[model samples]
Target: MMKKAPTPRTALAPGIAKVLKQLHCPLDVMLMCVRWYVAYGLSLRNLAEMMAEPWIEVHHSTVYRWDMKLLPVLEKAFRLRKRPAGKSWRMDEMHIRVNGEWRYLYRAVDKNGNTVDFLRRAHRDKVAARRYFEKAIEAIDADRETPIKIRRCKYLNNLVEQNFRVIKRRTRPMPGFRNFRCARILLAGIELMPMIAKGQMQCAHGTHPSADDQFYDLVT
Candidate 1:
């Protein structure tokens, strides 16, 4: 007898397989919930309610758990295949409330407005700025021997500032994040959404890839 084709679960990447081990939900459904949560301005309750329309029984907290578990895995996969950023960079910070206190979200984009990288920190001091710069350089897979020049003019930073509005709009509806860890995971996913939409990921699909295709490419 011929062997049966490998099941979707069996075909998943080892990292995804490990994270999803023992989960009762179908893989597509779980991924759908995670995608909708980060790609749109919907809360967990909103996602749970939406799923009920299709008769999928899932609790908001379950979705939250999925976010915490799967997002890091997904983000790591995306980073490996991410396209390099442009040389001219713009960086800035946005204020986000977490656990009833303010936190700094440092973000940067290239001149073309592609996302470079992001970091969340408690303080907006020089150390935090330095760390963000380091992270962005690493994210772009830059050559360590080449020095990167940073432009400090206020007018030159509008590209990243505009990018910040997209993130803020998505985060506004939810109640503030419960803690820093939760905020970090969710924010990374949130940052990831636009990058996918803009086709910043290198995939088999040519220049423009639909967000869904890119997301599945990362996970599977």
Candidate 2:
């Protein structure tokens, strides 16, 4: 007998399969909750209530747990297929309140306003800035042949600063993160939403895939 071909679920990346194996909910439901939480200004409680309207029972805490477990794996998969950003880039940092204290969030966007990457750090110093740059470079998969030009003027950085408002607006509804790790993971998912919107992922069918479609594709 010939060996059978792998079904979609079985063909998933090991990390994705591991996460899906543990969840009792359907894949579409889980992803919809995550996308709404990150892509919109809805709190977890709001999400739970919304799901209840459709008669699909889920708790706010369960949504939180799903975000904690599934987002990182999905993000890793996204990075592998992320498209390269523009040569000219704008970088900036913004303050975010985490656990009653303030923290720095380093973020960047290319000339066309495509997201490069983002990092949450405890401090706002040269060391943290250097680390952010390294992470962005790696995410874009830049090389010497195709040099990246970074511009650092208050006026020039307006692009990325404007982009920060989207994140802030989305987070404004929440009570606030309880710890560093939670803030980091949630923020990563938040940032990923816009990148997908900007058509940053390398879609096989076309350049601009719907946000919902792109998100589902990440897991598959």
Candidate 3:
């Protein structure tokens, strides 16, 4: 009998491959960067070092670029928009270091521990609060299916507070981020994993055919 020919790797979707290749990185590297950034709360430099390998070179600048470019896009793509409004919303703040100084992260979540919005501000004063609420409320207005009356519910807020711990563990190895934009992207990627793990997003496991293959299969 003749030996079987080797099967070729399927081509991925243009959009998916474009983004992945634009950063001069692999999907696993991109995913790992996000994971370490969010799960450990590590700075870009730390993550770069941790991800560095004998074959591939990992640098702090590369981490910075990945965060600034892809993190927000990932967040917007994966973020949940419409949900039944909870009776109340909870807001809180955490401090992280940027450029060797402390900065605050203001976050809001619904009654169900789902993220509403987040803001990074210089201080936690009334102005900062106003800014955070403005963006959060705007997001709620745009995404909500029904009108939700606001109430003060600390318990709901506590649920949202739980996110910090998970990211903190990941950050411990690196300590803090040097670039704020990169830091934001890292957070978005990190936050997205839970949603994916919970079966909310369709992940591209290597075993499956590429998006292009699916399209081609459909078209053909």
Candidate 4:
């Protein structure tokens, strides 16, 4: 029997390491704190208190600043590092309330649970759905990758709906977002968590020297 060839890993972007150097906290600690808030949808105040259990003292406002600073770094790093998703796109839309009125959240993922993309729209109509469909197609099309078909019906489109279900569950802790821009950013974070859980995103691991180096060098 022949051993399978190893898959090449994506290198961390140089900009990430450069920016992280000027920060005051440890890389692992900062990553852990921001991940908890993003993964669990904790309020900044709640996150600050939670960190206190481990003797890490930081204010809620500080946590807010950390998220603002760190999320874009992690988000871009993960996007560049993750593998291209499948071509069969499963897509859906659901209404979420922001500032007292409803809005449409368009979400789609490939078969392997890799999120294609998400968009928050002010209306839900043919034009909106079509726009989302085009975006989903664009997202899934990578080098040598073309989305073969779109699956919007419930039968084969459970992935996006399930993602929405998780989003709905996780978001219940926070009553509402202040505005659509903030709401979209939070939803994007929520969507990214699943990819990380699936082992499909940029991860820092001790056993992997390259990624471990990137993470340490950045966070230090």
Candidate 5:
């Protein structure tokens, strides 16, 4: 008897598997690693061990490097995704530590609850705020008659604040990221969790995603 071919869910997401396979790991193993970090909010070291089956042997650093290499590819693909059009938006900041120095995260959410933009900066002053606003406003489709107009955006800020609560909770479970790259990559994985949990995205795994709202602990 012939073996049944794997379906789409069991298969890799197009280029992802091929790229990972070329880098020395099997596609299935790579996908498991990716899914673990995206679905569980775990660190690279933790994910490496979690990814290992009882019959297989793997190193934690392997997972770390895999995450680092996979991040840029994920970002590129995510940027190409279509977003719903809108006029009203929100912008806000949340504090994080980069290289042990305080930094700020700037984010924008549209009226439709879609996350519009996410940026990291060293400070959260008016200049940074205005620059973030200008950057987001430019994405609007403006015309000669219907010029883009952004008066004041204070309410939209709440969405980002709410997002920060989720991020902060996850941060508390695993603290001291040791570097910005890890923090940023792990955060990217965490960002995907909300979409799935909030019903905005279909769960990649068979299990349903869960959403939470609470304050957590410090990174340091």
Candidate 6:
């Protein structure tokens, strides 16, 4: 017997719809355009230029507005997906300087280099640790299919530290955020790109296409 060929994936077929509805552009087109802007550090104008494949012309401001509008929706959808978490868990805390005032940023990453979750808190004491642990555990419990082992070695926690740098590097170029509310929203989108790159988040997984494949598939 002959095997059936796979169906062609298209923007209108099915995608991140909570965020992609009623838009003038196709689903994948808007997603990939935003993805490239984050993944390549491309300016909005640069991304707009690239969007002109044949006749469609997009402006940078349009892309900017799309990001501000869709990023939170994307983040919300991302959190609801079922993803695998490593059995070995590593946790860490770092000092975040916002407006010269210190804040505690707690993070946990699984052995597979997937970020479990992150939070910004005001303290690093036992109470803080306990609260942070509870929060991270909630996310881990939601995703992991098996039992998890907490690795006590500080060095092992380096995995989460690396994840921290992923966001830090992206935010470094900006001058500073006016407030935590603004900062949090911006970081939601920035951190999302790496998550996208890791194949940890998507609208559908039956085909299990990588994030890049979906985004590029939309553009072309």
> Which candidate number maximizes lDDT?
1
- Over 1-220, each residue of candidate 2 has an lDDT whose tens digit, in order, gives 3112224454677887898778887777888888889999998999999999879999899999999998999899889989888777788888888999888888878889998778788877757786668666765555566655454478988889899999999988888888999999999999999888888888887456577778877876
Candidate models: Cα lDDT each? 0.84, 0.83, 0.57, 0.66, 0.58, 0.63
TM-score for every candidate vs. truth?
Answer: 0.90, 0.88, 0.62, 0.73, 0.71, 0.64
Residue-level lDDT of model 6, residues 140-215, one tens digit each, is 6687686444435767767787878877776555555555654566666776667767877644547776666643
- When summed lDDT is taken over every stretch of 10 residues in candidate 6, the lowest stretch is 1-10
Question: Which candidate ranks first by TM-score, i.e. highest?
Answer: 1
Ranking by TM-score: 1, 2, 4, 5, 6, 3
- lDDT by residue for model 1 (59-132), tens: 99999999998899999999998998888888889999999989889888888889988888887775768775
The pairs that clash in candidate 2 are none
RMSD versus native structure for model 5 = 7.8
Q: Mark the regions of model 5 whose C-alpha exceeds 4 Å error after superposition.
A: 1-22, 143-145, 153-156, 196-220
Residue ranges of candidate 3 with Cα displaced over 4 Å: 1-21, 40-64, 80-87, 134-147, 153-156, 198-220
Global CA lDDT computed for model 4: 0.66
Error of 6 at 113 (Å): 0.8
Stretches of candidate 6 above 4 Å error? 1-30, 43-62, 94-104, 122-126, 138-152, 202-208, 213-220
User: The CA-based lDDT of model 5 is what?
Assistant: 0.58
Deviation in angstroms for 59 in model 2?
Answer: 1.3
